[model samples]
Target chain A: MARYGLRTVALVYLLFLLVLPVGLICWTTFQDGIAPVIESLTTPSALHAFKVTAQVAVLTVIANTVFGVGTAVLLVRHEFRGRRVLNMLVDLPLAVSPVVVGLALVLVYGRFAPFGGWLADLGIDVIFSLPGMVLATIFVCLPLVVRAVTPVLEEIGIEQEQAAWTLGSKPWQTFRRVTLPAIRWALAYGMVLTLARALGEYGAVAVVSGRIKDQTQTLTLFVEERFQNFDQQAAYAAAFAMAVIAVLTLLTITLLRPREDER
Target chain B: MATLYLSLIVLIPLAAVVLRSMEDGLSGFWAQVTTPEASSALKLTVVASLLVALINLVMGTLIAWVLVRDDFPGKRIVEMLIDLPFALPTIVAGLVLLALYGPSSPLGVDLAYARSGVVVALLFVTLPFVVRTVQPVLLELDKEVEEAAASLGAGRATIFRRVILPSLLPAMLSGTALAFARSISEFGSTVLISGNIPFQTQVAAVSIFGQIESDNMTGAAAVSTVLLVVALVMLVALDLLQRWGSRRG
Candidate 1:
């Protein structure tokens, strides 16, 4: 077959787009000598940003795990009126820009707005607050979990669930005993993606967080802020850490596939 | 109530934009969305997205083909890398491009291309969409067809053109539509790399953000309204094409 020539194009394409950029990021860490990168990572803000990133990621994952599973079951199991609309609505965030997602929150939470005024009367802060950052991240990353699990549920079949229920298993028990393990890999995969997304989200968080240094800034915004501040080493350091986390998460999702179903 | 929650969040803000857009009358709204600035942004977005998607079509098809057709060293790592952008926050993708082409970066200085830099960055981040979408199609492609084509003395190119490409085209179209929708609203990566220079680097989505910040809701809504229309139309067109292509297949 003349497929041999096509294979060359495919390999080169992979090398240029996927492999090279990752390699470039890795090389960037050591490009200006190890000292700068090392020193940058050691900085308290850089260290702090990494800790916050980890913390936020963990929180986002746990929240998504529950929410994702619930939403998936709601989406797949419940055949209600406007089911199609609900499906599309869940994925609306995917089509909207993260910036708009942030604005949506702002328009809801601005001082003059209904919710914001009440919260402010109580001295509550959202814009430029930790809550704002998490809310925006959650908004942007909402679809990933839903998308990951719904497909698995449909493809896995439901005879097992019916059998469990027929055998007198409670509704929740049927799901726990018969369905959870079936989609656990998908759950894990979605969690990893969500973790990576929360750590790196900036557009939504940027508009909402107000880029307040150290308090609500994410590693991504931290990198951008440092770039504007002309702190290249710190920017690189944050980018490097994010890159590491991304590569690791990507690794996890691909390696641990469920026994059945395509990823 | 299912749609009720969605309408409050998704439909209300969107409808406000549309209502205000037509409130000024159709001609005025047309003028607003088709101004030189808006047209250039629209032109760049559509043309650039098409260019990027076309490029990814070939690249994605090839990557998918290789992964399914052959085994290689670090195959799993290569596969993982292909999906990296999907996991990446658009902002992180933008950050990488900024590092790649900021005025300080060699690529930035050497290229001497001002606005195309934004296109380059957008293309980089959006590259994954088509690739990820097309890979499964390629993976599930029946290898037996190729063998049958080979036995019929069909050349590899002929086999692919007649056998594989035709089967994959529907998926590619659908994937490209998804990629187009994604690239249009891609403010995070483009904002940093483009520097948001008006009439040049400023795209529709960025302009919306600019207007919102300035409290020019009318103007912002106009731009966003155009984007919304384009997104709806593009998605519809893609859906029709995919349906037709699948039926033909």
Candidate 2:
């Protein structure tokens, strides 16, 4: 109704940019009989990949939550040498190529590197192991939690924290009672972003992951291996499952973010 | 403690990639990454990234214009959907493109070139950043000037060209730089659609990492150095432009 032209372009852009491509993927996934797709998705490798993805997501969320909360607090409250550099370094992993992150870890943890021999002798197996995949996820996903929490911490300001301190609440108790409640939404926001990212990650995790079937294979890597092996149905099915989770997580984030009314 | 953890996992390994390359003399390292294959991968990466960035330059600005200038239904939804790619896993983006442009797809079957699929893959993954970066600037734009241009009997095209285009130029350039920076490092999506073929569709990020998988650490280091240097230069350039834009603002 509004000059029709702008609306048409908006529709076309959305169709091309978001709807059609995602729709096409969902359609192909359900091809070859829904049963076959479902069966493939339930297979051990796909299941393991999903399970591993969940485990890594959980571990990463836990690790980065602590790291993110502490970083936001330290960053907002403390002044120290190299604080600016530290702030910049914290954001580096966000922009670092996942391929680079993976390869970097592979070099350090693979059999040829110095740490690899020590780890191998200890039977710790970092490369091509579950631990390695989780570690890579943590490295890449670290920035999300920090990004979410830091902005909120800055927004809420330090007046309340100072008030609690003035009220003679112990440092730990003030942090726990006053600061944590104020930042809970930001914390949830950060954790959700980490979980979503850890789920979809491929390159870095794939490199150090070794893609061991039913073991080290994360969902994204599993999809790649399946596609490369020309198990197209399995790949599509797994991709569909991942897409569903991703879309849900995204919607949740959008819903939880400060609304127009809130602002 | 977390910083130490991050340094061990990220910074040290990153340094190691550079160190391995420099262990060979600079000339020797340069010689390795300058091979015909490496040259072609770099070429492909630059061209594809530029193509993606340029396309997004037009489309992103239009979307930003729509979001900023117009009040419409589903505006918030559109804003969030624009951000979908940022959180969308790159691998899934690749898969999405593969599903859209593989041989069986309606357009893929009739495309001018066989490798149009790779372009589509790069396009989807790189589109959102350009859009996101530009959208914020567009929102933050001082609109009185554009409205003034409109009242002066300037036609739509004239207004866009003479008024809006100049102001949006810096953000567009910075966004394009970011788009290129991002597209070059793109491996997850490219690897899926390119079929990992060497010397043709293979990207630098993929090829360099492929060397790592094969334990050709020295050779991989050489290629990694090239990518690292290129990325560092581009990032520094982007930082300067961004600072310049902020200062002027």
Candidate 3:
């Protein structure tokens, strides 16, 4: 009886909090049939938003993957003075509000501040441009890959790399041949997480992007703009598409988990 | 190379925020943080986050316990649902909740433009923290101890309170702290639902966003500093808790 009661409570909580809300949005998106949903997604502005989201997500993932693997290897294998502090600082981005993230970037990189002014003089715009949006997304998604790969790197140890080094392999060769194979799944998992976060980022991008439609508006900004302008259909449709991406990411993560665990 | 990226991307910009907040000295920072609207928003955020954390401590633990100890049909689906919040876009999360609980709520339970609406949004975004934290510890737990307690005639409640709860508390608290920090900093999920009414449903993150929109950079930076301090403190606490948890285990 107690077990049944607990199950009921858990199910009810998830039903209302998780399942139902997501289901309702998907249902609402299609209530008017497929034409509006498709049309809403294919509008010129919507398509542009899609392009921007993709470009930013891809760049962010590539950057984070490199940074994540380097940081993980450094944290797990190398000894350094501020290693612990670096570990904690890697997590700083997660603790920050996305809005603060935007504000932080703007303060340092906007055209007014000293560094930003210098960059502006060089005709290199950082804030309120594609570079700003990418930077914001990268900041918000920075820790995912590092966090994911660090544990696996720790478990793998350095014996294999050491053997390769002893056999005359160069630094890059040892990493490419031995270390890379062991951590590939974990690295893949981390990239997936980074991609998911990059694609979903809104608040930080909002502050930094300047939200000029068809220019800086990513899909998330598009959703908010559409909803605020009373374009509920467009908002819901864009939202539904994003939701599908999220769900598919979840499924991919789930599938990858066992394989990640197997090694 | 890694240090270079971390310094440029993560460290410098954050330092800039702290420096910006101190531009007018400590008094100016204090004044910005203590404005009636700013203070009220900060208070609301802290209170709502505390409430959300306390609730998560209980409900999150319960869900983790069920996932580990209980079995039922479609359990895998429930497991997948647990991470949906983390994976979903925050704006979409706000929209979905509004669809269900907003003005035109099919269930007729309109929470939009209300403080409760703000809490619900935080809860949705933070749903994964505690459960994810506690589930692994529960899985690693040995059943032999419970069997030993049962053989000694320990009641179910006694076994739980004495045997299980002790081991679970650290992970539980860590998860709770992470959730609290997250709720304090939450923005996107609360924006549409809370309606951003000052001294009402507005949270600290939304308050910061508003300050930035109004070009009150100093004020925004000051309030942001407060949040950054709180989040840093929580991270330190989390570190200590994890070290303690590992030591005990």
Candidate 4:
């Protein structure tokens, strides 16, 4: 009886909290048929929003992957002063609000600010531009890869790379052959997380991107704009698309979990 | 190299916000931060986040305990579903809640466009934090202690409260703190569902967005400074709690 009660509470909690909301989105999105959904997604602005999100997400993933791996390797491999502070610095994004992140960018890069004034004189724009959107996305998603890869790097240890070096392998060869394979899954997981986060980023991008429709708007901004404009069907359609991407990422994480555990 | 990247990417922007907030000196900063609108928004954010964290603590710990200790069907699916929030975009999660509980919907609990809506949106976004944090700790707990307690004539409730709860408290506290921080800064979902009504459903993050939208740069920075300070404090506390938990374990 007690076991049944416990299971029931868990199931009901998930049902109300997770299942119903997602199921409602799926239902509303498809209620009017596939053609309208497709049409909503294919509109030029919608297409452009998706394109912006994709571009930002791809760039973010690439940059974070490099930086995340580098930082993780440094944190795990080297003994340095202020290592603890450096470690906490990596978690700043996770701790700070995304809106604050966007605001911080504007403070430093808006036209009246020091950097912003200098850049304005040079005919360059950061805030309310694609670059600003990219920067915010990168800031918000920065911790994903570092947090993901650091543990794997720590677990894999330096022994294998040392062995490779002793066997006359070049540094690059040692890294590629010994280090890369071990952390590959973690890196992939991090990238997927970064992609999802970047794609769905709303607060920071909303603040920085200026929500200029086809110009700076990403898919999430598009959803917000569409919903606010009373375009319920179109809004839900864009939302469903993002939700599908989110689910796909979840599936990938699930599939990768066992492999991660085994290592 | 890492230090430079951290500075450029993380530290410099944070420093810029602090510097900008203090650019007007302490009095000006206080006036901007303590305006009726700003204070109300901050209060709503803190209160809603506390409520959300409290609920998550109880429910998340329950779910984590069940998943760790019980044998159930579709357990893997349930486990996967728990992380749906982390995977789902905040905007999508908000839209989902709005779709189900918005004013026009039939389920009709008056959550949408109200303060409660903010709590619900926050709950969705932060649902997984506590569970994820607590699950591993629960799994790592030595069941033999509980078994030993049972054999020593302690009842199930007594054993849980005495043997298990003490160790689990730190994890729960840290998880709740993380949830609180996440909720306070939560924007995507709350913006849609909270209706953004000032002094009502408006949260600090949403209010910051509004301030920025109106080009109130200083005002936005001031409010953000408040949030940043609170978030930093919570993060430090969470870090310490986790360390304490691990050390004890």
Candidate 3: C-alpha RMSD after superposition: 0.7
Worst 10 residues of 3 chain B by lDDT: B2-11
Model 4 chain B weakest 10-residue run by lDDT: B103-112
Give the TM-score ranking, best first. Answer: 3, 4, 2, 1
The TM-score that candidate 1 achieves is 0.88
Native contact fraction (fnat) of model 1: 0.38
Instruction: Please compute the TM-score of chain B alone for each predicted structure, in the order given.
Output: 0.91, 0.89, 0.99, 0.97
| Per-prediction interface RMSD in Å | 2.6, 1.9, 0.6, 0.9
What order do candidates take by lDDT, descending?
3, 4, 2, 1
Could you give candidate 4's per-residue lDDT for residues B37-133 as a string of tens digits?
9999999888999999999999999999889988877998899889889888898899899888887775766688888888889899898989998
Looking at model 1, what is the TM-score of chain A?
Answer: 0.90
lDDT of candidate 4 over A15-116, digit per residue (tens): 988898889889988998899999999999999998999999999999899899999989999999999988887898998999999999888888888888
Best by DockQ: 3
Query: Candidate 1: where are CA atoms >4 Å away?
Result: A1-4, A32-35, A42-44, A51-56, A258-263, B1-39, B98-109, B153-155, B234-249
Model 2 per-residue lDDT at B176:
78
TM-score of each model, paired residue for residue: 0.88, 0.93, 0.99, 0.98
Clashing pairs in 2: none
TM-score of chain B of 2: 0.89
